[model samples]
Target: MNIVVPVWGDAYLDTFLEYSLPAQLAAGNVPALEGSGHCYTIYTTAEGRRRCEEHVAVRQLTRFVAVTFKSLEVVATYNAGNKYRTKSDCYAIELEAASRSGAAVAMLNADILLADGFIREALRLLRLGKRVIEVTGGRGLQDPIKTALDSEFREYNRIISISPSELSRLWLANLHPQLAMHYVDGPEGGSFHPSHLYWLAGEEGVIIRAFHLYPIVVKPNASPVKFSGTIDDDLVALLAAAPDERLIAQNSSDLFCCELSPPEHFVGDVAWRGNRKSIIDFYLGYRTENIENLEKEIIISSKPPVGELWDRTRRDSSDFIDTLISDLKSELLRRCAAREADDLMAKAAAEIEDDGDFIKAIGQMLENGHPIPLALEERSLRIHLKTYPDRADLLQRLCAVLGAQGKVVPLELEERALKAIVELHPDRRDLLERLRLVQVGLGKTAPPAALVSPSGEEASQTEVDFQQDAEEFGRAVNYRDMEPEFAPILELARRFTMTSVERMYALYKAVQYIEATQVPGAIVECGVWRGGSIMVALAALRALGNTERDIYLFDTFEGLPRPDDDKDIDVLGNRAINGWLPHARGNERSNWAYASIDDVRSNIGLIDYPSDRIHLIQGMVENTLPAGAPETIALCRLDTDWYASTQHEMVHLYPRLSVGGVLIIDDYGHFQGARQAVDEYLAKTGTPLLLNRIDYSGRIGVKVQKSSVGWLQKLGWR
Candidate 1:
């Protein structure tokens, strides 16, 4: 006997190879049949063939049986789009292949598990002069039970013996109690379809009567009719059997087979409609001239058990519909309650003026799964922090709620809250750990030693005052308003850059700083990936009517230069520095980081910025900064991520940065190397500069007065 299987898709193939095939092999039907001259053929796609071969090698399936694989050529019309067409094509091909073998063939679906001794029982009937054998033991196993059975089989390396009672228990658990009761008492019992026969294992072995019989095993040359996807399987069985040959329907009590329910073995009204079309097509195709005879045959078949099953089905369906209606009503009531609760929360939030009460209202909304506008929650939290700076408990609760909702809280507020919590509770190692994470998320390497007391002492009053002052500065710098003219440019720039709107607003602020201070110099950007940031600066410059200032855009214009592994490690301990290509798998140009110089020029052209004033210097910053960079810079933006690049840019450009010029460090908080380079350069210069936090990963600092001496003393007249 040759066992022919047709399977497709990764999911079905995985289940078939992992569970179905293993069950058959364990049942002594696969390798055990080699002595009886049994072979196996699997028909699948090219990719599926690769998977099957891999499985065969890993499981050594060929060592047991002479297994052969055939790749079914995928036809665009038949095997590509429609699943039904694919199934039909596979069956047609497998049947054709089986016919050529000149041996008894058992055609089976890939997504089914055969019972122990099923093949032997089929062969016994064949030896007893049965030309075509229909094995009636098709049971429907729900997904969860199928998963459990697969797990058990894999763990034990054999099919675990499940008694008929246990099988029935598993089947009933997946069904509603009312539905299960009806099914158990119905004419079909546990079978997949109403017209199908069902049998259970008992002391008498297995006893089954024919019910919409399917030809499980066929003798050589007996299958004259070709099978198709458009024709039902049972109809194919009926047509395949020769008029002179004997046909028998039987099942061994020791043998059983089950298909996974819901999907693999579909049930209910939709499945019936689909199957009915194919059955009707088969009958029409069987004898086109005998329409009357076909109708008579259908009427004859619809007598007795099917008629009884139909009446039972109607009654069961009525009960199921009533239960469904009750469930729907309960669902509607639950939704109404949820909506009322949401309205109450919104009303409370709108009425509440106190910052503390407002925070509580927002938190409650989040806890109850009510949607709260991100801007509203953010503004409320910021206001609460201003009024009650030491309320780490409320802050933590709000932050946790925001995190759970996947809402991104401003990193500044998160850092401030975590610092207060850590300082107030020095013994809280968990809080300290959380503080480190927040710091890393801000693009900083680690929390400074001074932030955490070594002796576990509570934060002093001065420390609290400093935190309050920092919070005040953050509020002062928050760019809440978008200038009307810059809005369109910002929108256009978004297409070229991944920088947040907040960061872009900060850039606009930098332009405002230069305008107010009358700082005279060009705008210099060290790492211009796609020229988005430079475009923002150009827009701001244009808005301020400072079109005369030359903007020097410096970059490799390929991607990021390779980082120094020892000095450029991230907080997560990843040495690969390109954020665009975190794993550093392929060439730098492969990802978003690699924008061409021509593309940047084209993007600038889109905004109609002064072409000559914009200097698109293309090369590594280390090499280009020495020759291509501007001599004097008023607004310098350093986005270079590596330690060496950042350090070099600071060494060459810091001196050229005029007094009161704004220096924006884009990767200062996110990249440890970038932060370290900025800190080291600032420390060497001994400049009294205040690096204000802009966003999570950006910092803006104005190069202020270098002298520590008083104005009068510096005059030398005193």
Candidate 2:
């Protein structure tokens, strides 16, 4: 019987070959195509070779053709359409008999060895409304993942392989290098494949044992070829460089002895030397190494020995001794109980309705300060909504999540957005402070503009005065960074920008900030809740023809990754009300809602700026730095009210101020986290400006500056 075997990038072909009976037609005789269907066109050497030829005058020549493409084959061998095992439509196949009712199709895993990037790619394909086969690995058969899996012959867009052991070490090395290497043994079922995966990380030895008792001929190279594993940084580099050594072993330790080799003959000459075996060759079944008086031939590769630690490289500077001492010191004098803290966080993140309300759930938990994991990230998203209180502020959600989580969070959209905003405006404290508010506050929509003009052209003098006064009120309430006395803005009032709907969201934020601190620029509230008043200031700037000066937005777009030390933070994803959850880096950008700087910039357009003056830096404030950081900032928006973030912004942005620049904080009125960080920072640096509280509605704004003259100037500006 004539048949066809479709394969992926040549890695799994032999596996299928071991189980199938080859036709009399030789292996090299089958035609192969790189990227098309009908991969192999087989012909009889001297007679008719029919796929299912029933010619009365001719005899059929049975042959097998191997194709590297994906196609559905209809054969009578087995019924796969109704009983397919997976959800991958883009897979390979070997049509043993497709001319009749049921057929045997090889559903190849396309996303072998790739990670982070594919999940989104698959989703993107699905979002275009395509039905993609979701591949996941877990013990549960009734889980949502299994329902998502399909079994078509899917295309292999990305072919990557990795060692499961290596993946564990890679993850650990990021957290602790020595610790990762120490425990990188065994098949850790802990690492399961996500939905985008076409293939899972497998033990090569196990596959080799089933494929062949003897070694196949594969040449050695300078760069080690990848077999299969997590498609992380190391795995990608390895696969791009060298071929894997395909060998089998009895135990895990013997994996080191595995070796891959190519045919031992020169290109054209078939000097059929001794048996094809050095030790365990499959070609001639354990042939001797010596040929009759033949010259020594060596298989030279492009690179050297492989699997040497690249990502797991541990330098003396980042060794265990240093980390151990640091961790030990930190473990002392801890205030909160560990289990209690974890329980509190988990409780904050659990049990939210998926009405996509976005705010109700996230706002509640952030107010409670919850953490999240993969199993309950959706719940985290429901909580993040409370942070913004504005549907249009969707892009800012990632910064809050990443800041609350860590550099690498679970969500991809959150990761990219956080990185972009932080990169564009690291010095802007409002980014962190607003993110904190998103972390802590219940999500709410922005109130109608308290300062608005129907024409929407410019703010009235009365409205401007109202905004200026609101700034003053916030300053009056702030006492932490204040001295004996300080003058305030005369018209302590609240005002909004001359815009509508989305743009008006900024006004609610300004009102909130205005209520937070009353002092114009002298008494500062570092982190503003919701940023209503700050948005007002930016609108005020646009109204006053300062469109050339950019309003920078800084944030950890993923709402802060898990905190490294003793720091107060809101629940994860709470800051991003009415938006998607946070995303980790190394994933595709499409998965993220505010994954790019454009997402953040797009949010600012609602403010009605000249469109050129709105700058965004997305990342952890510490991790995000502009190329040529300014020497002295004119207006330092300290939105990161927490001690660590506030401290970080001050250290970085303080040096960038011009004389008489304003450092307006969004959280000078509340949040002990901000208060502690600001106090210690000022104590160390000797800034004597006091924080006078401002209250315009529920927001807070503070006036901060270099001197009394700066304060006076700030007051005049307000």
Candidate 3:
């Protein structure tokens, strides 16, 4: 008899020779055929051969059976990328070797261990004209059982010469009783036995059959074609062979084997028997005459046959088995629910018609205590509100959830929903009050006075005072101390900005100065990377009741331009360049400074800032500032870090700065080029300005003295 094994990587090769191969040989599972002139052929890589030679078990096996190592590369069509195809090609080589030697071939997985007398029985069956013998009743050793027993078996050093019967005894005694005992007094008793019955119905008719075929032995030249390495490869091989010559052995007697892992798509433990049945049904459906017609009609038996021995074992181990089944069921349900939720969300995202299903999926996830992402939940609720606009209960629930989590609700969606609910039930003071509070949260000065009265009457003094108090309380929350009011700002900073809190607060203070001093002009910002600083300013403007100003934002919006190497070199002697830092020439899109115009627009939209008030001028400061900038700027934030752009902005925009207007120099302390531009402009114009330090990199200076000299004359260009 010729035993063929394909050992691939170092891990599989080491485990097979060290543990499985030695265990099989010690148990007398391999036939002692040294004098019979038959040999075991191992097809493996060159590395496999180098490692195999170091194994003492390989020398021991040579004493019983001739062991030959052949290069797996002999399969000229071997696909290294597809492991199953590689294995199939190796098997083809094994078949060719067996046919040439005129010996029966035992095709074995590298990861399996055979029982004593198994090879002898297979060869005997082959001699009786059984062209193919497929072994059944093979037990899969779960990892925990395999680990514990392999350790103990190695500690005892039993691999050199343990009896074959002892191998079965060791496994049967230690395996979970639910998997170990099968039948009483039958051939497969005291072992794990999995039998799958596949039933399929199609246009051709219904066919019911059992499918279990692996660890096969074949007579020389019995298999006609090489295996395809697909899931149905074994079935294809069996179908190709003459039926009368095929034998599905009743395995536990001497034809048993143990697999290191369960078959693909099948989980360990009795609870997952449904998965095994489903896998078999699926594969068998492919073999039917019409797969599309058979897919919906196919069904497999979920319950496997349980013999009297299993019943008796269940009585003794009922608690353990029940707990295992319960735990597995819970885990399986969780995974199924998560997958269903993901599928529903994807479907809803792909098509708006599935929003109802999406909502139910979120509700189910919430009930199951799964963490639904805030964005997903918000989307689901938005869809639900859109579909059923009159659902006030859902609107209330949304508000309560957002309030408890302190999450920013999609302001536009929530506001529309609240207004609709308030309109529908004008007498519901509670609904009106909720709408008023939502409006206040949204930075509205007050809910329209008519909204406070159902009959279009103005709100009384008491109601007006109440609204003012609420607004004051909303603003007075100590956000810098990490109050709940800071949650949305923190979230915005995390998503949009790479600036320190001090710098962000400086932007806020700039907004405060414009609001306090009543400086009249649109807010201007240069170098709006992802618009983080500008977003902070906008949020502050809304919070401080100064949202009327039109904001001017300037950026190349394609990331920074190629910096002047002579003028923009950093303190570390690395030139400031147009890419991700450190090497500074590649991966421009991934750089922290890179933000497309659309990204800034999206960030601004998140806060529901009025879009008409935002003027995003997309170009270098040198070109865009002169043409597109606001005529009178209350807040002139210069963040263009290079000397040329900074100097140009200082020359063109500084002269227009309102008296008492805030001038924020974002990189004054960090970028030498920016500091040079600011200092040069201040010196040339003789402007007396107090530049206060905000952080390590930021400076804020109120424009106390407007420059008398024109920007062009100050640059000596006119």
Model 2: per-residue Cα lDDT at residue 299: 12
- Candidate 3: the clashing residue pairs are none
lDDT for model 3:
0.59
- State every prediction's TM-score relative to the real structure: 0.33, 0.27, 0.35
Q: What would the per-residue lDDT of candidate 3 be over residues 335-418, giving only the tens digit for each residue?
A: 468657755754554454476666676666544434344456557666776777668656855654454344655776577767
Per-residue alpha-carbon lDDT of candidate 1 for residues 618-672, written as tens digits (9 for 90 to 100): 6566545554555567899999788988998999888888777899999887788
Clashing pairs in 1: 205-253, 206-253, 442-669, 443-669, 443-670, 444-669
Task: Give the 10-residue window scoring lowest on summed lDDT in candidate 2.
Answer: 291-300
| Local distance difference test, each candidate | 0.59, 0.31, 0.59
Model 1: CA > 4 A from native: 1-480, 577-592, 708-718
